[model samples]
Every structure is written in C-alpha cells, then in structure tokens.
Target: MDNVSWWAVASALAAGCLGLSVPGLLATLPLRLRPLPRLALAAPASLALIGCVGVIDGLLHLRFHWSHVLIAAAVIAAVLWPIREKRPLWSCPRLSALLPVTASAVSSVAFALVLLHQVPSFDLFSQSYDNLFHLNATQSILETGNASSLQLRTLINTDRTLSTYPAGWHTAAAMICQITGVSIGVAFNALAIAVVSVAWLPGIAWLTSLVVPQRQRTAGLCASLLLGTAFGFFPYALLIWGVLYPTFLAYALFPSGLALAMLLAHVWLPRWAPAVSDQVRPWAWNDRWMLLGLAAVWWLGAFFTHPRSLVSMVLLIVPLVLWICARAIAVAWKAGGARRRRMLWWLGGAFAFVSVAAVAAILVVFRVFHVASRPVGDHLNGPQAQAVQTVWDGLWQVLTQNALVGLGLDMTGSLIILAVVVLTGLVIALRRADLRWMVVAYALIAVLFALAAGSNSDMTKILTGLWYKDRYRLSALLPLLGVPLATLAVLRIAALTRWPRVVALGSATIVAASGWAGLWAPVGAAAAHEYRLENVKTTDFVDSRQIAFMQQVADVVPADQLLLGDPWDGSGLSWLYADRRPVFPHLNGQWDPDRLLIAQHLDQIESDPAVCTALRHLNVHYLLVSTGEFDGGDPSGNKFAAIDAAVSQGLFTPVLSDGESALLRIDQCS
Candidate 1:
C-alpha cells in the first residue's frame, strides 16, 4: 500500500472496464446506431444483466462466479441475433467512419488520466461517509454468495429477511475484484476510475449530434469529449464529496438512457416540428419494440445501481415526456370525430391517472428512505435569506459555466471561453424548436437546484429529499444538460472554422488551462483529501496502525471465529479486511437479541450468566476494542459501557495491540 502498484491498478482497471461494459455491448450489438451512441448504451445494459443475474442466483441459492456474467451475455446476444439488420455483408468500412470512435477513445483516456492524477492514490479509498457500508457490502457478496439486492440487507442487519440497496454497483465491483484477483479496495478504486466514462463520453457525443447535427462532422464528438471531461462539477464532484459511487455510476449511465428515451419519444410520436423527425433514425416497428425493451432493461439497471439517480433521470426527462403526450393528443384532436375525441379524452384520463400513481409511488419511496419530508444534514443551517443567495449563486454558476457553486473557489480566474459557448449554445437551443425542450429541461433542473440549495421548506423537502436535499447532486445535474449545450456551441464554431477539428481540440485546452476553468479547485481538493487520507493516523472507521495490526489478526485468531468490535469504532472491519467475521458488521443494524445482550453486558461475563451464555451461543470469543468512531462523534462502538474495564482489571487475555487498537480473547467465558 506504500508506493502504488501500477500493475495491480492496470489489471483492476482492465477487469473493471471489461466486467462493466462487455455484456451490455454484446446485447446492444443488434442495434444499428453508429459507434458512439451504441458504445455509450452498453454499460447500463451490462448493469441490468449483472444485477438481474445476481438476484436470480440468489433466489436459486447459487454462487456468483465471473463466468455467470459471460453466460448471461451470451444468452442475450443469441436471443437478439435474429433482429440484426440484414444489410452489411462483411464489407470493409472506410477509415473516416472510425474517427468518432478513435477520438472519443483518446479523449476518454485523457479524461481518465486526469481523474487518476486528481486522486492522491488510485488504490486507497477516500472513505467518504457511505463507502464503509458499500465496501463491506461488496465483500459480503463474495462471502455469502448472494448478490441480490434483497439479500444485501443482511449485511447491515442479520435479523432482517428482506431489504434492498440496489447492489448493481456492488455486484459489478465484486466481479471485477474476483476476475482480477485484487482486493476489494483496489477493485473499487479501479471502478471509480473506469466505470464513470463507460456511458458518459459517447452518450454526450450522441446527444450533441442528435440535438444539432452541425453538418455530420466529428467536431461535435471531439468537442463533446474534451469539454465534457473538463468540467469538474459532475463525475469529479461525485467522486470527491460523498465518494457516492452508486449514484456516480448511475448518473454516468443515465444520460444514454435519457438519450434513448428521447429517441424513443421521437420514433413513437412524430412531432409537428420537422427538426425532431429529421434528427432521429427512421427505425422499423420491430426496432422500436426492441429498443423499448432494451430501454426498460436499462431503467432496471439504473434502479439497481441507485434508485435516486433513476428518480433524478425521471425528473429531468419530465419535459420530454410531457411534450410527447401533448403532441400525441394534438394530433389526435386535429382529425377529430366525437367518438375518437371521447376515446382520446378517456386515454388521456388514464394516462393522467397512471402518472399520479407513479408520483405517489415515488413519494412512498421518498418517505421510506426518509428523504424530502424534512431537511437532512446541514442543508440550510443559516439564515433564511442566505438560501435565496445560494439559489442566485447557483444560477450564476450555471450561466458562467462554473459547476462548483459556493465552494469558496475563485471563479473569476478562468477565461470565459466555455461560458460564452455555453450561452451561445443556450441561444441556439432557444432559436431551434427541436432544441427548446433542452432549455426547458435545464430550467426545471435549475428550479430544483434552487429548492435544494436555498430552501429547507416542506415542499422543498418533497422535491429535493430523494437526493437528501444535497446541492452538490443538484448542481452536478446542471451539466447533464449544460455540457451537451456547451458541446453544441463548440460544434457550431467548428462548422464555421476552416479547420473545424482543430477548433474542437483547441477550445477544450483553452477552457481547461485558461485559469483552470472547471479543473482547478476540484482537482486540488480531491487530491488533498485522497492523498492526505493515505497518511493520516486515523480516518473514520480504521486507522493506519490499526490496519497493519488487522493484517496479523487472521494468523492468531481462527478463521471460523467471530470478531467482537464496534463497526462504528472501525475494528468491525475485520469482517472484510482480515477475513474474520464480526458480530456487528456495520454502523447500524436491527441486531438480534443475543448480540444485543453481549453489547450491553460483555464486561460482566465473569459474573453475569446471561452475558456468558449469549457470547458462547454466538461463538464470539474475541474482542476488537478501539476508542474512535467515524466522524469523531459517538465512540460508543458496541455499546458495552464497561468494555475498557477489561484492560484495567485484566479480565481478558490481550492478543494484539497497536496504539489504542487491541484484540483480546474472552477467557472467562471459556
């Protein structure tokens, strides 16, 4: 863990890339889209495949091996093989056609390097709040041989029979680690690096092309990747703040799903505007059905990755959904008969009912997750007017092509090239009716961001709660629409220049290097956090010395025994790190009575018959004691009030110690 192992990083990166993308690519090969869009769609497709296979394997009580994923992909490819368009007879294509693929690939590599260098270490984790739970859960999948989202709840609470955490991210990480033979920590870092761009770059490229064709040039592709990757608001902000890997993966994959959904809208419902029809492929009926089916699978995949992102995706695409329905109704009314009109009204009523039902279901999920009903965390701890100011700052940031809102970074240092283009793109989108919906979508997202960042009102909670009312998430979304608009503006510039492609490359460089437009502060902060964490004596659950001591735990303690420690205190990580199970595997869980008994009276084992009985029943002979907790808040750990009494009175045999971290055996119970 000292000097980084670049070879391990490389293998983990390759395996993570293949595990996340290959299955989806094979499944989507039957689609006739050009290279960029097709490639972008592959990742989510694979997510759907992997998550479903895990769930199925869980129901049937089967172990999840890496081969199971490949077999699933083969089955899907074989099933979809019949629908292949009968056109090409193995004819060689021109080299010009490969430009988009080649350029995008190169840009992805550059972007990936920037992201890695931004992080202090490619192997060590950032240890943001949620990572401990996610990391332990990924390890649990390998240990229990049950990767079903439903089965994941046991990792948090052994007493629970049913719960879900959208294990798509975990399932994929498990497979990557298994295939590459790397630790979960290394595999996860690779995923954090590779899984992000799998959907994003091509998705944005296809979207830019679809929105504004700009004379069928590769400049859009070039500009999209370069400018798209330069912005630190999105994918980078995510990797840093919460290290919100599940949401990060879901967001990367959602753009393609959104683009496909928009395409489906165009194909199924012809618009009054000619531009909408002209931009989309003229798919056959069979193709539409097939695409719809794949889109459904992608939705499931996104849900499996993280339901909140699916919620975000659904929220962002509301304008398009409303437009499609409105267009269909208008077309129906124009050719009206009383009977047909009546039927149209009935269908509209039914659609409205279903929409209401869906909204209700979303609200239910919000309540279940304790989101949106009340302010969460530090959303608005200041005065009321500061909320308004934050909203204004957010709008200003979006307009100026600054994604980091109020992070205290100097915004004026960067040149305004990207800002000017983003505004120009906004102007262009407003003028073109087909592109107008994008502006509408952007506005809707901005309003949501305002509610999230500025207000903690009940209505605000309802709207922003699913995201835990986090401005970082809402701010990150502005680029979901803004980045494509920026790419569109660059593509327009490229169209006018004699050297269009050169303009694309040069523009990305100016914005990136021009006072470090979007790349400066995020890179500094992320690197500082990641690199600093690597050397810190303590971070959240586990400490540096504690980690080294844990490496020796398995040698002294039998593999079949369990560790007694507070998950909050970090020693509970022995379950995942040292391959020794812990009585409490997470910070919180619906613990069984026996574990609860030991937690309350473990120090009284010499005199309390109940404590000894519970310890022996659970086979908990070893105790991992530490005085620290994640976030430096509550160090209650396993809640044994007199636990440290053992150290003072020699109640237990000391097995190992490194600073405050110690391992002990309960001899009195034996």
Candidate 2:
C-alpha cells in the first residue's frame, strides 16, 4: 500500500473506533455486550456514521474536504474522551471469554486472505458488470463533492430525473479519495475488501452470539468461521459477480442491525404483554428506550447503505415480529384473573397489531408506489439459461458425482448433509416452541432466494426484484443465520453420543472446513468460464490490452470532453479512469433524447450530416472505439467502421491510435 492507501486504512480504523465508541457513548449498550462483540459493533457503526456524512453531502452537495474529515475525527475523539474518562478503555474478561473474539478475529483475517488470494490486487476494479456504475459514481462523488445517487444519472443520461440509488459505499470511497488523494477505484476497492473481510466476520459472529446463548459462544465462533469460508455465492461470488459494493457493505452491517432489533423486540415484547416476559429472558440492559433508539439508528444505517439490505432484514425479522405479537396476544387471551388486567392486555395486543400493520403498510407503499419508477431493468425477467446451468453444474455435480469442480475433495456433498442438520435443528427448536423463530426466519429467506433462482421465469422475476433478482445478493443472508443453527445441531448431536468432546469438536471443524471448500468449488469453476479471469476463453471480462487501451484513452482524452462509445464494450470505463464522460455509460436503460440520438447515429457519423449535427448538439467531442465484442453485441466492427468513415470524410481528426483502439476528435463542422 502507498501513503494514500495507508492513510485510507488509518481513516477506516479511526472510523471503526468512532463507530464502536459513538454507539457506546450514546446508549452504553455495550456494557451488556462482551468486549469483542463491542469491537465488532464499531465497524458497522463507523460505516453508518460515514454513510450519514455521505448521504448529507450527496443530498446537499456538500464538499468532502480534508477539513471535514478532520472535523469528523475531532468530534469522534471528543465524544470518546469524555466517555472513556472514568471507564477502562478495554473490558477485562476471562480467557474463555476471549475465545469468541479470537475466533472472530481469526476468521476475519482468514477471509481477508481468501479474498486477497482470489482478487490478488486492487489495481483494477472487479470486472463485474455493475462496477462500471459504482466506479463512475465514486468519481462523480469525488468531483461533485458529494455521493449523490441522483447526480450520477449524468453517466446514464444527462436528461433523466434524480433517482433514489443508494450511494453510501460510494460516498465513503469518495471521502477516502478526497482525503488520501488516492484514485476513487482504490478507495472503493480498499473499503469494500476491508469491510467485507475484516468487519464482516466480526459482525456475523456478534449476530450469532446474540441468538446463541452465552453457554454456546463456541457455536458463535463456529458460525463466524463458517461465514469466512462457506457460501461462495454470497461474500465471494458477489466479489466476482455484480461486485455489489453497497449491498456488500449493507450486508456486513445487517446482522448488527438484526441483533439490535432482536434485542429491542425482546425488551418491547415484555412491556407490551407481561405474561410472555416469563418465556423471554430479561436483557441485562434496562434502558429499553435507548436500545430501541440505537436499533432504529442501526436500521437507518442499513437503509442508507442499501435499501435492499433494509428490505431483506425486514423480511427476515417479520416472522419473529409476528411470532412475538402472537405470543403476546395468546398471553393476553389466557389471562383470567381480573377484568381490568384482561382489558389492559387486550389494549396492548391492539397496539402491537396497529404498530405492525402500520409498518407493513409503509413498506408496501415504499416497494409498490415509491420504487416502481426506478430503473432496475427487466434483465432477469426471463428464465436465464445460465441460471439453470449454474444450478446443474453446482448442486447436481455435488449430489451425483460427490465432487465440486475446483476442490479435489468431495466437500460440496455437505451442502445437502448440513442442510439436513439445519432442518433437524429447526424441527427440534420448533417442536420445543423455543426461539425457533430465528431459524425459521433465515430458512424462509433461504427458500425465497432458492425460489428466486428457480426454473420458472415470472416467479423468479418477482422474487428477484425483491432482491434485485440477483441470487448472489440473496445468498449473502444464508450463512449468517444458517451457521449458528448448524453449530447448535452439532452440539446437540455431540450431547446425544457418549463420544469424546474432541470427536465432536473435530467433526464440527471438518464440516466447517469442508463447507468452506465446497462453496469455493463452483466459484472457482465459474470464474474461469464466466469472467475469463485465468482460464481465458474468448469472452472478455477484462484484459491487459483493455487496461492499457483505457490508460491510453485517459492520456489522450481531456477530462472535460465527452467520449461517445458503447458502454458495454468497456469504453465507458474512461469516465472512471480518465474522468471523461460517455454518451451512454451503461446499457441499463438510462434513456434520454441525446443518448437516443447518439445511439442511432453512432454507426452513421461519417456518412450523414444529421449524425454530426446530433453529435455536436450532444457535445460529444470525441469517440472511443474498443476492438472487443462484449455482452451487448459486436460493437467493435461497426464503431470502427464509423470511425474509419469519419476519418475518410475528413469529419474527424485522429488524435491517438493503438492497434485495437483509437481516440478521434470530431472536427468543427460548417
């Protein structure tokens, strides 16, 4: 890492500390939490606060300067100094108490290493499709001094109205870029890798701890480790897929928000219906209002980070909420002592019903009315051949052949095996009518994702819109809930047998390692095929020549001029690397008259006067033509044909040329 990168890391650290301390200072909630879990809270908390800054900057167009960053740091320090004035900086805990924290730290480091091993370096952004938008958005935030999702519409179509895209991750990256003078790509990549690998593990572990009692801290550890290695589609596949950075950041923080919600509900349920209080254990923290306030804040953080995360978290928690309400109502109906008491209980039930109904109505409105206008595109509407093939190759191979493509071991077979274990745990938990709601909630989410990835197109589309229709996005939620249940199942199985403790621990460890390896199998196989990363088929995810060509384009094209080219062919990347704008930066339906004109006339620029007129009107001063055909179509030949025609007709002046790419400036027309 260079100096700027180091500074970015330092800034992340400071943000982490502030994130942890701010919540502590405000709620003193960590007083009830273990030391390590408190540290985990800092990561999301810092990101949330930084996200808030980004949101404000974007909405208000506030410049993110070094002074602003320094001021933010100073405020954090001021808050921390007073809070730590009387209390010890670190909590003193027994050695056994440190196991969960140690496991979490180890898992984070391991996950970071795994990601680094796969991604290798942050020199280039992931070749995932959405990175085009994310990188440009980061650049826009850096230039405009705010992470405005709406402002980024310029990349799509200059004429479109502001849209409600979440820019929290981009905003944080912009902050890093502003302060460190590193490239936006560097800042974005760095923050993403750090949060996902380092912060994400601890966050998951802490969430697991929330549901897993103090006695089963080992289960939490196991779950955290499992998260580090298992479910390649989630944390790893996301890196290679859309590389959905905002969703990744939000997902990292989601569990913490969930933990907070669970805590809030635990506290709230007792108050709303006292009979259920006997069933639910009392939280050590007495400040129910404070906890609720903190939970709400955490939820806001998730919302700002990514609306998908908030939606998913809400979906996961809805069952738990309903179950709690039902228990409360049941308790109220069962109360037979006094008329006044029964009336009060009924009143509490009514209040719960009204509150739940109101929240549900608001969410429904947000989804149906508010989000209907946004441009998510119907890309995943049809039954995708690739989805079916992926399922066949991944799950089928594991089941029938007893092997995954990359891993030499038969590790993937455990997906079925552990799935059974999870189901068994859920059944037992439900039979006892204990805290099985948590297991059920996650299971429902998992099933929803599976259904979204199902063979049927229409059902998949509807389910997919619920999660942006990305299986990887939906898959991210599974390990957080599944691992803990798996841990509990393992513990239960161990208790049933007279087997030595070592046998049980060893078995769990093997399962964790195998599950991790299994998940990596399909991802590794898919990487070479889908992305052309190492295995280099004719498909173009990215290449050295493209990178070199982009660098050349950056060198020749002025930052101020707009370059017209096919975004699908990687020409749009100049906006991120070269600070040049593209007429059509992406193919995701950001339509405008100018964009339509450019697209229609792109192949006719040299042959027709109208094409030149439209180009001039759009102020497209330059053309960037890449020689490669990509996902959209074979734009390489047509674009070059247009370029060649322009040069022949003396309509364009050649500025720079490489073998497969050329930069041409449109000549002044009479």
Cα lDDT of all candidates, in order?
0.71, 0.57
Q: Per-residue lDDT tens digits of candidate 1, residues 223-268?
A: 6666666665676667666667888888887678877877777667
Question: What's the number of clashes in each of the models?
Answer: 2, 3
Per-residue lDDT of 387 in model 1 = 46
- TM for every model, in the order presented, reads 0.88, 0.78
lDDT of 2: 0.57
For 589-670, candidate 2 gives per-residue lDDT tens digits of 5567656656655556656677767776777778776665455454233433443344445556678776666677766543
| Cα lDDT for residue 381, candidate 1 | 42
Which pairs clash (backbone N, Cα, C closer than 3 Å) in model 2? 19-46, 20-42, 464-469
Clashing pairs in 1: 372-461, 372-465
